[model samples]
Target: MPRNSKRSTSIRFRIARSTVNYFRLIYQTFNLDIFELNPTASYPEFEKGLLATLKPYRRPHAFLPRTLGFAAAIARSAKSVFENARPIPFNANQPLFVASTTNQKLAIRPIFDEMTTDSFWFDEQCKECVSTHANRLRIPFIPLVMLKALLSKGYRRKSFRHSVATYCEIHGTYLAFRLAFASSRPSCIVISNDHSAFFRTLEQAARHSNIPTIYVQHACVAEHFPPLNFDYALLDGQDAAEKYANKASRSKVFLVGISKYSKSENESRWTGSPKRIGLCCNALDQTASTIEIITTIQKSLPDFEIHLRLHPSTPASEVDKLIRKCPAGSVVRNDAKTVNSFAFCKSVDVIICGPSSMMLEAAMAETPVITVETDSNTDVYGFQKHGLCQTATSAHDLSNLIADIETRDRGAFRKAISYFCEGFNSPSRPQASSLAATLIENISNRQQIPTNWKQSKKHGWWRYSSNEPELEAETTA
Candidate 1:
C-alpha cells in the first residue's frame, strides 16, 4: 500500500477504538473496574465480582400477622413450581445465560421472580429454572436489542458502533421483559436503580404493561443528579431523599435506610489510641499524586503505621507497585478478607483518602476522616457540605492534617457524625432485605405510595442511562 493510504487506515482505526472507549468511559466513571484494564484479568471473574456487588442481598419479608390485612408475602420455590413451562425462545447457537448465585439466592427467598441484567452464567439449575418458569426467563438475543437500540433516538449518538453496543444491551433487556409478559403481566417490578440501559428498558416494558416499577437506591445521590423516571425511588435515608426527590421527575421517594451491602456490622468503636492511619485509595488515575501524599504523610508521622485499603476494583499488581514505592514496614496494604474497612477505621486513630464514599464509611466507623483532593471544590458524598470531615487540597495540606490529628479534638466531629448518621440511616432501621420485601409487597398489594414521598428534580436521570446525552463529537487523540 502507498504511505498515504496506510496513514489514513491507521487514523481510522484509532478513531474507531477511541469512539468505543468514549462511551465506555461513562459507566467507568461510576464504577471504575481497574482490573478490566489488566491484560490477564478474565472477563468471567470481572463479571462475577461486578454482579456480586450489584446483587441485592436477603432481607426480612413482610411479617404482618394474619389478624391484619397485610399477610406475609413470602413465596417458596417448591410451592410455585411450573414443571411443564415453555422456554422463552432465542438463538440456539448463542450460549444460554444463567442466573448468578446471588440472583439464584434472591430468587429462592423473594416472593417475586427478579428480572436483572445477565452476568453470563448458565448453570444447570438456571436451565431448570427456564424449563420450570419459561415465561419469566426470556432468553436475550443481541441482534434484536442492537437493532432496536440503533433505531431509537435515545440510543443514537455521534459514534455508531459504541452506541449500538450499549443500545443493544438495553434493548435486549427490554425484549426479555416483552417475552416474559407476552401472555401474563407481573404484579410489579422491583429494580436496584433505573440509571442503567438494561433497567431503563425493563422500566419501559413494565410501564407498557401498566405494572409499577420501583427504583431502589444503589449509591450516594449527593446532588447534581438527573431526573428520576420511575414510579418510585426507595431511598437509603433522608440524605438520599433530600438529594434525589424533585418535582420534574414525577417519582416517589421512600426512606428505606442503608443498602444491604452498606449495612455496617454495628461493631464500630474508637479505641482512642494513635497507632494506625487507614488510607482508602479511590483516585487510581491520580496515582502519582496519591503516592506523593502517602510519602509525605509517612515522613511527617514516622512512628504512626499506615494501612492502605485499595478499592476492590483496583488491580493487585498496581497495588504491589504502590507497596514497593512506600517505606518498608511503614505502609501496608489492607487484606480485604482479614480487615473489615469499617472495623479498620474504628481501630485506627484517623483515615485518609481521596474524596469518595470511603470518607463516609470512615466517619460511620467513628474514625476521624480526612479527604485529600487536588480539586479544592470537590466534595464527595457531601463530606464538606455537611462538615463531616477534614479536607486537604495538596500533599502539604495532607501532611499538616496528619501531623495535627493527634492533638485535634474530635468531639464535635463525632457529634456531627451522630447527626449525619441519624439522617442517612433510618431510625430503628430493620434488616435491609426485610424492609425491601415489605416495600415490594406493599406496592404490589395496591397500597398507595405516600404523597410525602416526593422530591424536586434539580438534576435529571439520563446521567446513568444509555440514553444519556452525548458530548460534542470528538475522535481519539
Candidate 2:
C-alpha cells in the first residue's frame, strides 16, 4: 500500500476495533447486539428509504409561522431554485466568506478590512455584536423533515448514542445550510474546524450549491475522523501541510502559517523563573487525570506555582468540581477572557498539557512544554515525536520531569518549536491571514473544482476503507 493508504488503513483498523469494543461493552452490560447494521445493504439505498419514510412528516408543518418576511425570502430564492444563480464575483468590493464564529472573524480581520468585505456569524449571542460590527444572520430552526428523520432513526439508538447524533446532524445541518444560502449565497464558506458533522454537511451542501469551502486549521488534525474534502485547507506550516497533504488534494493544501489569533514574540528569550508551570486543559475527558497530575506536581514541587488554563470549550462546572478537589492555593485556574493563552505563556516559564493545539500556541510564545501522555492523546504530531516538547507517561514520570526541568537545553528547544510550527521559524515567514485571504480570492476568481475526496473511493458508515481488516482505533463521534 502507498504510505498514505497505509496510514489510513492503520486508522481504519483502530476505528473498527473500537466499534467492536463498544458493541462488546453494550453486550456485556445489556446483553444486546443493537450496534449491528445491515451487512449487505447499500448506503444510498438505506438513505433513500429513510428519507422517503420521513418525507411525509415534513409536510403539514402548520405550527410554523408564515410571516411576510419568510414568504418574501422564499420568493426571492425562487430564482436560485430554477436558474441556479452564480455567486457574486470575488473582489475587493466586499467579503465573500461566511465565518461561523467571532474568533474566526478576528483571525481573518486583516483580509476582511483590506478587501473591504463583509462577514457574518451563526451565533445567537453574537448576533447583536456581529451585526453592529459586520453582519449577523439569525439561525434557522431545524426543519420538520429533519426532526422526523431523527425521530425515526432513534429506533437505532439501542445501537449507540453516536448513531442518533450522526443521524440528526447529517440532516439538520443540510437543511440549515440550504436555508442559509438560499437568500444570500457567498462566493465561498470559510470555517475554522472540521471536527463537527455540521461542518461536513456544510461542505457537502456548499458543493451541491456550486460554492467552494475553505477550512482554516483551528487545531491539530490528528484523530481518525471522516474525510473532509474541502476545496482549500490553510495550514500552519510545512509539517501541517505534510500531515494533511494526503487527506486533501495536494493542490488544495496551502501552508499559510499558524493561527492569526496567536501573538508570538520573535526571539523572546525565556529567562523567566522555571518555578511557574502552566497546565493547559483540553476536553472534559482529561479533567480527572489532569487534576491528579496537578496534585502530584504540587506535592512534588511545593515552592512552584501550577496554573490551570481550561480550554474554551471545557465546561466551567467541570473545572469547578476539579478545583474543589485540589488543595487550597495549590492550583489556580486562569480566566480565558481575562488572560490570553499566549499571555499566560508569557507569565509562566513552562507549560504542560494533554494533546491540544495550545501546545503549538505556547511553543510559539517560546514557552517550553511537557506533554502528559494518556489514553486519549491521539494527536499524530504529538509533542514527543516532533522534539518540540517533553512527554511523561505517568504522574511519577511527570514529577521527575519537573524536578529535572532546569537541565533542558533552551537553545535547542526554541529551534525545534520554530521548525515544527510555521510562521514562528522566522520573522520573515508569511502571515496566516494575508496568505489565507490570497488563496481564498485566487480560488474564488477561478472556476470551482471538485475536491479529490469527492472522486476517490470512500468507505461505508464512518467512511473508512471497506476491504481493510478491523484494527484498534478511537470510536467515531
**Best-fitting candidate, scored by lDDT:** 2
| TM-score of every candidate relative to the true structure | 0.60, 0.61
Summarize candidate 2's per-residue lDDT along 44-143 as a digit string, tens digits.
3233333332232122223233233234333433433444333323333222554555455555554554442344433444232222211111122223
Candidate 2 weakest lDDT stretch, 10 residues:
32-41
Off by over 4 Å in 1: 1-156, 159-161, 183-185, 222-224, 261-264, 283-285, 336-344, 403-435, 448-477
lDDT of candidate 1 at residue 2, scale 0 to 100: 100
Clash pairs for candidate 2 = 13-471, 14-472, 14-473, 94-117, 95-117, 95-118
Give the Å shift of residue 134 in candidate 1.
Answer: 14
What TM-score does candidate 1 reach? 0.60
